[model samples]
Target: MPESFPAQTSAEAAAEPTVLARIEGVVGRLTLNRPRAINALDLQMTGLLDDALDAWEHDDAVQVVVLDGAGERGLCAGGDVRSLYDRIVAGHPDETAVFFRAEYALNARLAEYPKPIVALADGITMGGGIGLASHAAIRVVTERSKLAMPETRIGFTPDVGGTWLLAHAPGHLGEYLGVTGTTMDAADAVFCGFADHLVPSDRLDALRAALAAGGDPEATVRGFAQAPGASTVEAARAWVDETFSADTLAEVEERLRAHTDPAASRALQTMGQLAPTGMAVTFEAVRRARALPDLRAALAQEYGLVMWFGRTQPDLVEGIRAQLVDKDRDPHWSPASLDDVDPATITGAFSDEPAVPLWD
Candidate 1:
């Protein structure tokens, strides 16, 4: 077997670490080291990851890169939103903008990366985590993996190129998952096309060992998973497409509210519980993203909308407060109803204004 990634000489073990990196044979492994925060991707983590990926991309010896989280809680929860919330509380808008712009650029880079990338997502992947994993060439999920784009629940639309991924998810399942912040396990993720492979968590070590030994990374990963059955989400496709198939968010919600089907009823209840402005923005963003040429275009569009909504609107703060900050389960929404948002407001969110650049 070939030795650990020898492209970078600094693969030696370290005592104190921010993020972890090891070069084993042809694979460069990056582990998000902030286990205490469930491996949240702060600006520092994003920068480090981008830098490492850039290095690995050009280094011919590194044929692949592996991304995963540490300490077992999950892969990554996303940009440490609580920090962004604190910035908002401090009246610093540029802070959040800078963080997202850099992060989204990283996401776009990953999507367009030339080399093979594998993400072993084990648990609680959400928000920025979705950005990291969704763009990978190979995504592995385990029974412990719970994936979601839950920004709507936290008073933000799903950013980090979420609009792109959700727009492309099988059938209208993306629409349903995006709007509802629904959480799914490995099976559901594989069925919905979010995960490329589903392996038990216990098999990760062996799989990594094989990859480190210069095994065919792609086949090595596939070897761990059996062919999954048709997705449960796939079963709900007809109903999802019909109920969510509307030109506007208002009409979509109305259809959900009026429908008597059990699934529709449950959807309506979840919709009722979410922030009105967030729901409207999310639905609208996903719709607009579908027309974009590619993931980068979708991310750029989403980047513009989030800059406007995250800072100016009270929903982000209130949502974060209730969901993450205070954990009160009560968010006093500003408009209080989706109807309160006018057409101009939604249109303005999508305007191709002077958007913040992804890179300096």
Candidate 2:
């Protein structure tokens, strides 16, 4: 039997560690504990997760690992962009890079961990949340799960190696999802390769208990898995592929305008609300990532692009401010139209080296 449960003091939830760690029989569990913030990862949380994984990797007692979040909101909402914004506004934008270095490193670590890591991707999972779940060996999503990488809507391109996942998605779905930051339902997540099993939300507890009881990892989860039903997002595949497969963002916009599908028209309308620069760069990044050899290479590429955006003081700042800080939902994006974005600038991000290399 396990020595103790990893539960917080039921009456005093506020006192619990930001990351709650414990061993449940052979399963080592790590719970993101910032329920109020929806478990948005900060550098400290990354360190905790890294430390736990490192400890569990070589421990014979830990045959499996389960990652989850506290509270009803979701697994995670991504990195605390508001905290990132404060650092940028304070002229210490480089500090933001430190967080990404650690977070990206942790992400890569989880993907390649020796032991099977099962991620319970429930509730709101987006941005960094996807980083935690999408790469896991046994990614289990519940009906309540909401997945996305909504960086573009805030004028930032998707980071957290989202391009790699997005690039590998069916047809041009990557471009559509990456550039629009559209939310994905459980079925969409499974169909797009972002997730694996569609276990019902109610069964999650029993599933976790069975895994904790030392059941075979894959077989145990599979026992509880159910079909996720048809993906509403994939239903738009024909239009998505046609509109997003164009050679350039301009071509994509033109196609979106010309396509008769109301979804296409909706996508066109959505694009109008996004940062032109973000949309352009995201399209380039997804295409670039699809050609990269592996997740680490993609991370290295993403590290470069994100650093450039952070230091250059482009749309990311305004986007965060408008959408999050000010809550105005009105971002005055520079180079307001996609036509105004400099192709050279997009290409230059790919060529530039990060001041802090990711592996370092």
Q: Give the candidate number with the greatest TM-score.
A: 2
- The alpha-carbon root-mean-square deviation between model 2 and the true structure, to one decimal in Å, is 4.8
lDDT of 2 by residue, 1-360 (tens): 000012233454457778988999999999999877778887888999998998898999999999999998788888878777888888988788889999899889999999999999998899988999899999999999999988887777788779999999999999999998888999999999999999998998999899999968999999999999999889999999988999999999999999999999998999999999888989999999999999999999888888888888468889887877777888899999999999998888789877778996
lDDT of 1 at 332: 88
Give candidate 2's whole-model lDDT. Answer: 0.88
Query: Against the true structure, what is each candidate's TM-score?
Result: 0.92, 0.95
Q: Runs in model 1 with CA error above 4 Å?
A: 1-15, 352-355
The pairs that clash in candidate 2 are: 74-124
Which candidate number maximizes lDDT? 2
| lDDT (CA) per prediction | 0.79, 0.88
